[model samples]
Target: MDRPVNALSKAIRRRLGPSRLRDVLHGVPLGHPLHPAMAMVSAGCWIASAVLDVTRSDPRASRTLIATGVGMALPTATAGLADWSTLHREQQRVGFVHAIMNVTATGLYTGSLLMRMAGRERTGRALAFTGLGAVSVGAYLGGHMAYRQAAGANHAESVSHLVPLGWHDLCSLKDLPNGRPVRRRLGYIELFVLRLGDGVSVLADGCSHLAGPLHQGRVTVEDGDPCIVCPWHSSVFRISDGSVVHGPATAKQPAFRTRLRQDGVVQVRPAD
Candidate 1:
């Protein structure tokens, strides 16, 4: 089993370079994985069509719903391509199966749309039923990717819940210099600590976009306010409140509350 998996991995690595796969998987602008969103859209369209079947809607309404479902196919294709580009060998094997199922479903919908256009009511209804059934199966596999495999899920969100409320000794106040972002590790958590002239600020070291290391990022004061720019994707967060001033990141990084101890040591803890 291991031999086959290793051989497959090498083949995939040669076909899709590591860096190229990383870019697609990262979903740079949205911050979250694109596949989930596309899945939701596809699911919503099919569900709406199922609902429309029961209601004797006007011809215009039927056309609209069908159009929406057909339009959703574009993003579904984009998201699938992005996810497939990044999958590991074993994951790719599973993903290929998932993709084929979804493609079949999409083809069924396309056939349904054409039959409707041709005024073949009975045939269109049959095709829609087939497409709906395929969508249900595809949805189950998508859930497996999200919940079981944890693909495109944020692992770092669990870190804050594990730590105690009180401050832990980070480093001496003088150790971190002004205008520089330093990397510090606390257990499994890596932090990016920045020193200002009067105070210090800290954020999770990993970029929420693709887990890009923030320690190597640049510090620039945005709009006369202190904020740091992530070097990899340029996602910016404010120093004072840890709010995301700019994004690709819809979710803010976990910020740490800091204080200078009497012994000139700086202590840090996860903010409530």
Candidate 2:
């Protein structure tokens, strides 16, 4: 399962690299994952079709709504696949099963739509109800991947509250080599430190999208500002203020204020 699943995901990811279509699917401009949001379209249409069936409302309208749901499912699932390709192994495994369930539900709903068009009202309603049940199961798994596993959540959300107030000693300013990114620890918190000329920039070591270690990522200059690109998902963050330069990451990276003490020791504190 892992082999086939990983191969599919990797192929999709490789094909999608930094394209505008991929950005749109990922909801980069909207600052959120688009999959769950767009899914509401198909789900709402299906529920309305069920209500029409129960109320014995115009049969023609009910059939139209069912067909509408089938049309909507295509784009919704496409958006979902875009995000699914970037998930971690655990999330991807669960997502694979979830995708299978959704595909099954869509097929059932399509059959129901065709039955209604053929004037087989009783059969259509039964298949529609069964499809809804399949959707429920798929939604449950989707929620687990999101809430339980924290698939698309901000990994560095706790940094501001966890670090102590005021300046905490990091290391001597001389220790960090020029034009290099290094990791430093303060208690349990880890920070990514970069030295460029006379200035030092520090940010939370973890990527906000999936907690990819920022220290392991490649640093590059984009438009004259230094940024780090996450190795896992390629989300980029500006080092100066930790703002997103590019993303699947909707949240800003937690940054810190750096200053030198009297003895030439460097220290950092949470940025306002």
Candidate 3:
């Protein structure tokens, strides 16, 4: 099951590529993932519909609300499916289950809508309640994916606090070859260090997309500027300032200020 789903997701992502539509679906311009916001809208409408189902005197108003809720769910599912395609295998596995539950809920609500239209009020209400249960379970799984697995989160968000303010010794500068990414440690923090000419650029080793090790990635030039392309997801970050050059990632990698100590040791600190 996971294999087929994984294959389909990868194929979908490959087909998506980089486009205005995909960016809009990703909520890049909005500075967040679009799926959750759309999901909330659909869920709110459904909640209102469920309340009206229980407390309303007129079945017309309840049915109208239910229909509206169902309408909102279409866009919500579209946004979710767009995000789902970009996820890693483990995340995709969980998200696939989440999607299945949501589809189940949607199917149930569709049946409920048909029943209501046919004047089967009690049967419609029963089906709507059952759909609500599916939504609840789906919501739980979605929460787990978001918070527990850190799906759609900036994996490098913690780097700012984790890296100390003052320069800390890492290793000898002579050991770092030009045009190669090296892993260095400043106390407990791991950093991706790259040398180009007289300058050394350092960033948090973790990819912002899914914590892919940036040091393991290939360093390449994009439009005459050095960039690190994450091995896991191909998220590209500028080596100069950690800005995202290309991404499934929306957050910038945490860059560091590098300096050479008098003893020829390389030291680094949090960037301004």
Candidate 1, residues 65-182: lDDT per residue as tens digits? Answer: 6668778877666656555544445555656666667888888878877887898866876887888888778777777766776555553363568777678998888888888889
Give a tens-digit lDDT track for model 2, residues 1-272: 79989999989888888777887887777778888888887888888988988899998888888888889899999888888899888899999999998899899999998888888989999999999998888999999999999987778775878876788999998899888899999789889999888688999999988998998899988889899998889988899999887767767789998998888788898999
lDDT per residue for candidate 3 within 90-204, as digits (tens), equals 8888899898999999888889989999989899999999999999899999999999988989888756687656678878878999888988887777899998876889999
* Candidate with more favorable, higher TM-score: 1 or 2: 2
Where in model 1 is the C-alpha error above 4 Å? 1-38, 48-64, 74-104, 133-141, 149-152, 158-160, 229-234
Question: Considering summed lDDT, which 10 consecutive residues are worst modelled in model 1?
Answer: 17-26
Specify the highest-lDDT model's number: 2
Question: Can you give the lDDT of residue 153 in candidate 1?
Answer: 55
Question: How much is 233 displaced in model 2, in angstroms?
Answer: 2.4
Task: TM-score for candidate 1, please give it.
Answer: 0.65
Please give the range of 10 consecutive residues that has the lowest summed lDDT in model 3: 157-166
Each model's TM-score?
A: 0.65, 0.92, 0.86
Which scores better on lDDT, 1 or 3?
3
Write down the lDDT that model 2 would get.
Answer: 0.87
